[model samples]
Target: MKIAFYGSSLVSSYWNGAATYYRGILHALARRGYDITFYEPDAFDRQQHRDIDAPDWCRSVVYPATEEGLRGVLAEAGGADIVVKANGVGVFDRELLEGVVARARPGALRLFWDVDAAATLDEMRADALHPVLAALPDLEMVLTYGGGPPVVGAYEGFGAAACVPVYNALDPATHHPVPADDRFACDLAFLGNRLPDREARVEEFFLRPAASLSDRRFLIGGNGWETKAMPANVRHRGHVYTAEHNAFNASPLAVLNVARDSMAHVGFSPATRVFEAAGAAACLITDAWEGIEQFLKPDDEVLVARDGQDVADHLAALTPERAKAIGEAALRRVLAEHTYELRGAQVDALFKAAMAERRVAA
Candidate 1:
């Protein structure tokens, strides 16, 4: 089957946190004999800061961030078995959606893959007349990265034919225990891009913890965090690349996973960082979220914290052996159930079922 996916940059993690997730799922699908053509706009400075070129697994096409570019992308996507307009494409998302839906082949399945379902749903609920919200009913299916039943129900409420979550998973090949590097070595580390939706939580979960535990070493990795007045104990490393993730996770005594406001509010949304850190065998401490236990058991496979004090307590109580055991257990759980290969299979099945239903309807 041939799939056309239009999303954020496939070649850069500069401002794109979904890069790893995209690579994992697409690479797995390609390995399973599915052909994929990824379309990404040349805006967002991603092209200037690409970490990867076109991988042999799939064709990566970069187009201009203009009207002509949209036409070209639409033309290229015309005949695919499936066409996906992923969330956070960083340019003219509504326009892209309108065009993809209009120009898509009659038999082709159109899907809206919401990497940020929490934010998307919140916006959709707030703005009933939003073009994208109005367009939801026209799409074949809506997929999300997080939010369990509640998210699905909400999308269905918005007139979607169907909605489901394709949760983030570990790409074991890329994330695993590696020899620790001195540069990233710290008592606790949190890696994420600085975004308005998540900055407050970062302050509560990461910054406050750092302030309380001034003696313990802390590291913050990702872009756009340099301007924040972080505690002295917390060191900010701007934009840690995907290539450095394993070492970055391994070196940290216990990594932190702080969910964005929308994700935390809606629940069941585990960020890619959660799986990546767990896959690396890094003991992880995350803020309390409703469906966290579905992914990682509290205090057994992972540590759950409700506030800065909880994080501080976790850091203080973390012994080398305890950390090792927690990391091992989480890794075991992730390997057993959460892998991109598994997600790829799930996606393939969803596509097949949709096609089968379409055939029966015809």
Candidate 2:
């Protein structure tokens, strides 16, 4: 199968939150003998943030960021068995839709893989960035990277023939724990860039905890966090790279996982970090989210924090042995169910189902 992915910044992991997520699915798909090509628009500053060289697993093609990007889309899209338009690419989605309608082969699988389902739909409804979402029924199928119930419910209500959630997953071989370095070692750490809507969530989930745990060390990593006055206990580091993620996870006494607007609104949705932190055997303390228990066993596989007190209590109570056990349990659960291999298998099943349905119609 020649699968073409058109969305987001695939070649760069610097500011891409979905880096691990994409790598997991694509690498697993590659292992299954599927030929994969990821298409990302070449935005300004893309050169500066180029982190990973194209690997053997999949080919990376950077198209122009403007209307000219359609040329790259048109050129590489040929001979693809499946062409995926991923959510949150922030450009030329409508043009890609037009290109698919005008140019794709009748048998070519055109899929919309929405990482942000509710947010994407909401924006479309509001005439926000992704107004092209309403044209779903004309596409082959829709797949969500997160959002379990709400996403499916909403997409179907909007008249989609097929939609499914493929949740963010882990790749154990790459993310297991390692010895920690002093620079990354801290009592508690949170990693996420600052976004407008998520700003309040950060304040509520992280900053308040930092204030409560003034005696302990807190580290914040990711971009767009500058120009904010944080408590002295909080250490603000700019974006951490993909290579340093495992060490960062290993060194933390406990890692904090905060979901964005859509993930939090939809229950049981797991972000890429949840898998990454667990795969690295880090005791994860995440903010109280709906449907969390459906994915992870609370207080065993992971710890849940609702407010500042919850965060403080979890950090203060983390014994080395206990934390290790929690991390181990989380890792085991992820390996069993949430690995990239499982995700790829799910996609295979879904893709075959769609193909068979199409065949029957013909």
Give the worst 10-residue stretch by lDDT in candidate 2: 128-137
What TM-score quantifies how close candidate 2 is to the native fold?
0.95
Put down candidate 1 lDDT per residue, 1-362, tens digits, no spaces: 88999998889988999999899988988988888999999987888888887999999999999999989898877889899999899897988888778878888999999999888888877887776686776798998887998899988887899998999999999888899999999999999999998999999999998998889999999989988998888899898888899999889899999999989999999999999999999999999999998899999999999998899999999999999999999999999999999999998889899999999998
Error of 1 at 92 (Å): 1.2
> What tens-digit string does per-residue lDDT give for candidate 2 at 262-355?
6677666777889889989999999888888777899999999887678888888889899999999999899888889999899888877887
Give candidate 1's whole-model lDDT. Answer: 0.91
TM-score of each prediction: 0.98, 0.95
How many residue pairs clash per model? 1, 1
lDDT of each: 0.91, 0.81
